[model samples]
Target: MNALFPALRTRTDLPALRFGAETLTYEDLGRAAGALVTPILGAGRVAVWATPTAATAVGVVAALLAGVPAIPINPRTGERELAHILGDSMPGAVLAGADDVLPAGLADVPRIDVETAVDHHSPVSAASAFSGAEPDDPESPALIVYTSGTTGPPKGVVLSHRAIAASLDALEEAWAWTEDDVLVHALPLFHVHGLILGILGPLRRGGSVRHLGAFSVEGVARELGAGGGTMLFGVPTMYHRIADALGDDPALVRALGGARLLVSGSAALPVHDHERITAATGRTVIERYGMTETLMNTGVPVGSRPRPGSVGLPLRDVELRLVEEDGTELRAYDGESVGEIQVKGPNLFTAYLNRPDATAAAFDGDWFRTGDMAVREPDGYVRIVGRKATDLIKSGGYKIGAGEIENALLEHPAVLEAAVTGAPDPDLGERIVAWVVPADAEKPPTAGELADHVAGLLAPHKRPRTVHFLRALPRNDMGKLLKKALPEALHG
Candidate 1:
């Protein structure tokens, strides 16, 4: 029930963060925050757009410490979507870099140029005024995160301090993180994966983190080989590229070997990539399940047997139930049935800001009915089938989760990324279709060959009936497959 920044400021001399060529101890960061807060007093909400660095992290912490809600908008979003979020959040001021593009309407707001803010000399002031007051009641909104809208326009999810605290505490307990641990931080700050798990989670536990402004396979491998960090969190795509870059470096191998844990999320990992990573790193990549709404629900246990292809059990204080198509709750002990996943826990977001209708529709009493389909194994492990109705491909009376076919397709040597959708067919009600990104354009696999490859690994009904090769697969801002957009793109 304590505000995070205020609590951390007490241990001012501890190593706080390392980014690029810069470093900031907790004391320096607290003072920097105090300086930033001085001019922005009474600003209820502040929007920030800065280069992903220690400065940006300090800015967010500074805003929180000042009792101002911080909204970190993605720099690459279209002006239209950017304007919508700004209008909705109604920020009192904006902190943006000179090079950052802003919506046309944003010029009217008070601006704090980030380029000049970070250049100020060491802040010479007491940090007490900036320390936020006692925990905003557990349900009071602390952060607003926008999820990529598959159903409609994006909506802001209001997360409370208690919700975030629950997630971090559960993560630390499940993974056994200690103050001595150092985390590698290269993921985007706009996403919960990086903002919460990558930064806040480690910081809350007194652990150190090294932040990377961007992800480059060669650059990241070099950092890992240097061996200062002990844990890595990345999306599946990032892991694939990093594994490929390591090739045969003994130092890279040793660094990966030394890490306490390597985590993957955002998208499901192809079993082929998973195998390659384990072979090269000697560490099984721990895949966890989460979304913008629920920070994190489950993860494969550290130092225990990692059940391959499963996301592992629910974290401490997380409760999960699987419901059948008939609206009946499926027994968790049943080994053969797959059902929709509904979760209720302290870590789940309270509601979508300004979207009371969505808040009402997303839940059933206390449980938030996550639109993900999963099956619980006899051993208490849960393997994701994929998203609920939207991602379920119906072809010739058989229902197949697109993720499964895509996962199988990725195992082929030539396939780089794959998206599966149902295409209109004359004979079948809906036909299985796949759009793929090939690693080698000069030697792309034929539709027949790719279909055969998938058929060899899957049942005839589950194999993709048609295939098309593309330069890249489409993904939303958060790196989730845009299945609804696929049918249009495929036919367009």
Candidate 2:
């Protein structure tokens, strides 16, 4: 069960990854990992702050080999959030970017220069006998993924190695990935998608991966069209961007000529955009469903007709159920009965880090009640209708999560506060209406500008159809935005 890297390292040497101009074979990458492990030679944790580059990947694997949990820090995360995570996790050491400063309270902790570590020879000290001890007990914390909370605070979900591995195994089995496959790695490594599916999934199957610093539609299209990779994973936004970038370009279409699968997750893929992408790239978007707590649960099978607005069937090891408001179980009918999605499997997380109450309240017995609301078709395929609470917006057969949209909107400089909610629309099932509190209320960013901002950041379907300015959002005594009052603007 242990010695994952050591077991994989035994395989034949082959080109494992291609990033920028650097090509790292499995043997070379494994040796680099061995070298990096020498810096933090103990069982604790280490934070990685970089994109999904070959060196970063090697450092992460090295930390794991040394029995050190790798905490991937989001490069875009504010300093305050970084400091909070570092203080909370209290890792033994940090492998950070050359220019990125250490968190305030973490100045006392050991910080190994990653470039120096990479330059050193692969240490043979711990390679003889790596720690077989489980860094992440079934109940103990392995990885801490921060999710935005109602109070703007972040909650870290602590998952175990078994849990994450189970999810990756399920994904590998479901997607039918093999060593012959080449995955285009564009998602941020800090997120579950990049860390698990982009890196671990491919590595586990001995498949090759091509890492990108960030998702660039043109870059991806050029790579795919040039026969650079076979498989591509991205959110709906990235796919739409690709579609836009490849508009009427016969060259781009020919570039993705040999790709077998194009995956879309993180958020729902708009039905229109899905069709547009298929028409543009000659590839059907294989949509899937999962969150931070659970790595992967369902995916549209390869070579199968992707059901419109449906995330497709659950994985072999996964179990899914729908329940009414009274906790009444609902079966798959014609895919119209909306209910809360409950899942139970080896892939599910152990618990929320240091939040027993949240963990206990999140489940219905052994099943983890995913806060998402969905309906299952007669064939057992699931279509996410909306979120159970907090963040839910359904538009034109697409169920978009608000958290993802808000995260995108905040990326703009002029945006100070942004909230997305479903506004009733006669044409498109539901139109996304964004209420934003601008940085300067008097000279707020124009609706057209804000729309363009989101358009650049998000997919066509996810962009707010209407932008409404607000002095301040409606908040309760706790200062949490009351989403319940959000619908009034549209209905009135």
Candidate 3:
């Protein structure tokens, strides 16, 4: 019932956002965002060209202030994917920066330049502007974020104010987040991790965020070392770069060593990189697990030393369980039995927008099936193996998780990057296959050697039967590996 960002009203003069050299205090943000609220109030649903800039944040904030559902479209989205999102959401208008060149798909929709709106209404106070607005409702849809849609057209996950607030609050408890903490990151703005948590999380806590226009180790070092950023959030790829750079850059080691928290999400932080960073900086990067359908399910709590492979315990109020194939809940947390993760919590999206069938299928009673597979430890830690649909490989009567094999392959000195999948074999129902980007292309490790490396680390059955070497593994914008996009030739 209360405003999502309470600090916007009370903490008027404190620095709220920073993108490169530009900075906006809480007062500046409120006025700029508040000016756009009137125009966005009655809009059925607004689409934001979610670029990583002040305008994008302002536009989304304005939509939320007016209680209108805001759909964030990724700037780098391909034409076909952009078309699908525009057609699916049917937004009444598109909000973008003053100079942004929009695609033809958005040509039919009305355009709103967020900068011009702010300039035209500089006199408006956020409090005075929102005074006449409709009362806040916790259950109202706040954001409609689209999934990666690896299988089909991306589905819009309808997130409510309740879900967003609960997620942030739960994270506040877990991470010891507060207004004094300054967060820094280079994640894109369209997804929940970057937009909701990276941006909105700070605003909700009345904290500050310093966003690097693009990710660079130098930028990370500068921000944390001198810019007063207490926390850093990034995907594994960015951290991998940091891990690689730490050995050569003392400033980076010092920057990361001094930070209060370093969080990694959007993909698994390979244990190799994790150990590398920790060994260099004496800081363990906290990893959390979630999907667009659920804002957040689990995270490593502050002051707790995390296990190398675990994502930590479920956050406050989130009910999590590992379930068998037949939907039977697994009670043993021995850390070996793998099962699909099913969650019941307030930090969950209401439904898949415009797809009742998908909305219905996503839920098993009150629990939302996360499609992610994991093993639970006796101490309540959750170590995710992979996605049930793509990462779960049934090979030779054993249910093998591609993630564990990928991690094992990464442990080998010759492997720079690795993705594991199953391919059909005449003898075995499916055989474990490893797609590798070798550390040395000219003298790559042989298939037998790599397989033997994995067998030495894990069981023999978990070793790769086939190994394909590549220059690079396919990855999405957030550094998540596109396992489905791997070469068809390798499978054949």
List the candidate numbers ranked by lDDT, top first: 3, 1, 2
Question: Worst 10-residue stretch by lDDT in candidate 1?
Answer: 116-125
Candidate lDDT values, in order: 0.76, 0.71, 0.90
Which 10 successive residues of model 2 have the least lDDT summed? Answer: 116-125
Candidate 1 residue 375 C-alpha distance from true site, Å: 1.6
* Model 3, span 1-492: residue lDDT tens: 137988988898899999888788888888888888778776799999999998898898888888889999998899999999989999999999998999887899999888723343456877777775734578999999999888799999999999999999999999999999999999999999999999999999999999998999999999999988899999999999999999999999999999999999988999999999999999999999888989899999978885777899999999999999999999988888999999999998998899999999999999999899999888889999999988898988888889899999999898999999888888888899899989999999999999999999999999999989888888889998888878853454
- Residue pairs that clash (backbone atoms under 3 angstroms), model 1: 12-27
TM-score of 2: 0.77
Clashes of 3: 0
Superposed Cα deviation of residue 404, candidate 3 (Å): 1.3
- Which residue ranges in model 3 land beyond 4 Å of their true spot? 116-122, 488-492
Tens-digit per-residue lDDT, 1-492, candidate 2: 233443344543676777778777666666566556657766377777655566567667666666667777776677687777777777788776455565565576677655422322444323333445325354345577776454455677777777777777777777787788888858777768877778777777788888776677666766776746889888766765666666766776766656878888877665656776777766788889998887788888877875757888888689988887688998757666677889998878877666788889989999888878887788888887667775566688875667556656766768766777777799887888888878787788887787777778777788888888776667532123567766564354
The candidate with the higher TM-score, 2 or 3, is 3
lDDT of 1 by residue, 305-359 (tens): 7565678899999999899877699996654467889999999998887889999
- Kindly report which residue stretches of model 2 are placed more than 4 angstroms away from their true locations once superposed: 1-3, 97-105, 115-141, 150-152, 390-492
Give the number of the best model, judged by lDDT: 3
Residue runs of model 1 more than 4 Å from their true location after superposition: 5-7, 97-103, 113-127, 131-136, 332-336, 424-428, 487-492
Which candidate number maximizes TM-score? 3
